[model samples]
Target: MIHPTVVSMVAAIRRRANEYMLRQLSDLGLEGLGPSHAGILGRLFQNGDMAMAEIAAAIRRDKSTVTTLVRKLEALGYVSRRKAPGDARKTLISLTPKGRALRPAYERISRELTELALEGFSSEERKALMGLLGRVRANLSLR
Candidate 1:
């Protein structure tokens, strides 16, 4: 059985990481983009333009939630919706110029996060930690 101390520590660490990342994102003019928005933006950055359903599946969020996020992003001029050429009923979501400009700041914040998370770890230890995390993720996926 998992120890109570370990569970509490894990919860605390998760909360701290979330708060720190959100603050960093806000400092970069990414205000209003909470954890949900961050997940959408991250997916857009890596995968380029995608349909609303595609994004929802990629992020494992319900379509309604993603739609709300897309609406907010559209209002902020961070994303644009275009009618698919082949299918008029389908809309594709892509980032706008303003959104593209935020990529560098996003990357910097991610680097800062990595550095902070690994501050006390030796190079070997960091590598091992990363490997273990990847394995854990894979194991969970099998379930």
Candidate 2:
């Protein structure tokens, strides 16, 4: 039996995951909330308020992309920005009440996404897969 190519399989999985997340978000009436936005939201949910540059770094996105994402979130009433204390040049981002209200749905979506991605895998297999994926990511990160 021929083995599937790693790059192709990873790409396909990423595409499917993004599509699934988009559908889930749409079903929850969150139109226009894409994966990049989700990443920012997830970070804010876990880490509370953070500076714009910090959020960008945490989400592994560039400042320009984070700027756009933050603007969209702000427009949706999901997040707000404030000037950092003692640092006029720095802007901090935090979830508004409306955004905090999304925690339950986000948790549910996260659980569903994990189950969907790992369906039929035993606990040991899941652990192994996670380790292997982490190693692959580390390998790719090397210059």
Candidate 3:
């Protein structure tokens, strides 16, 4: 049977996955970026512009952390922040053309990461794995 430490296994996987992602990004000449930025960029790519709070919620990060990530992306010219047209208080974040250009590479990396993570899994096994992981995530998010 498998070990009883699911949390430890999950943490180890996350660390290794982030390390793999950082290596890939470094090879692509994205030196300063980290896996944390992926959540923001991916959300923007899928949902278009979003406010800071929305981004934080989407990424499951706190507002302050999201702000810092956004600032780094802004400095790198991957994203831009502007005031919401309707409410000047809300800052809307959107991808620059440079950010959009990363779509293909990130897509490939995401696919390759999944493939590596599920190297031995069959289609049904992959589906079951995803379902289980989703439930795990839900359980954690309920805290």
Candidate 4:
């Protein structure tokens, strides 16, 4: 059973974690991106191509915001958008080679940031924290 206090504390911690992570990313030359944009990029990097609406749903954002972000990425040459061959009204989005090239750098910076955040945590503690985070995500996803 989850206590209300525990839930509240967890939520606060999550916010703090987000702030800290974003600050670290800022140090790594990550700029001009809000949380939503970062979320979209991460999703695209992990899941490959997707429809605009699908990307919006996956990122828990609205379609208009996703469209703007997609346009920005497209202009930056990081992504490309095309009408799906079978469906003219539906657009498919995919990361370009330049975007794929960013994966290694992003991964490295993220790993370094995570390591810094967990500097004092033991290996077992880090594993336990990761497992708990995964379970929390799974629980939220089911809803």
TM-score leader:
2
lDDT of 3 by residue, 23-117 (tens): 99999998888999999999999999999999998888999999999999999999999999989999999999999999998898899998999
Model 3: worst 10 consecutive residues (lDDT sum): 1-10
Over 4 Å off in model 4, which ranges?
1-35, 131-143
lDDT of 1 at 104: 84
Which residue segments of model 2 deviate by more than 4 Å?
1-4
lDDT for model 2, please: 0.92
Assess the local accuracy of residue 23 in candidate 3 as a C-alpha lDDT between 0 and 100. 93
Candidate 2's displacement at residue 60, Å, is: 1.2
Reference-based lDDT, residue 64, model 1: 90
Provide C-alpha RMSD values for all models, in order: 2.7, 1.5, 1.8, 4.1
Tell me the deviation in Å of residue 1 in model 2. Answer: 8.9
Residues 1-143 of candidate 1 have per-residue lDDT tens digits of 96576447757877887899898877766778765677788888998999998999998899999999999999989999998889988789999998877788777777888799899999999999889878866777899
Full-model lDDT for every candidate: 0.84, 0.92, 0.94, 0.80
Writing each residue's lDDT as its tens digit, candidate 4 over 1-143 gives 95576468788876876776677557766665444466777888999988999999998889998999988888877889999999999999998998788687667756776777799999999999899978987897899
Query: In candidate 3, which residue pairs clash?
Result: none
Candidate 2 vs candidate 3: the lDDT winner is 3
Cα deviation at 55, candidate 4, in Å, is 1.6
**Comparing 1 and 4 on TM-score, the stronger one:** 1
Q: Tell me the TM-score of each prediction against the true structure.
A: 0.80, 0.94, 0.93, 0.66
Error of 1 at 103 (Å): 0.6
* Runs in model 1 lying further than 4 Å from the true structure: 5-10
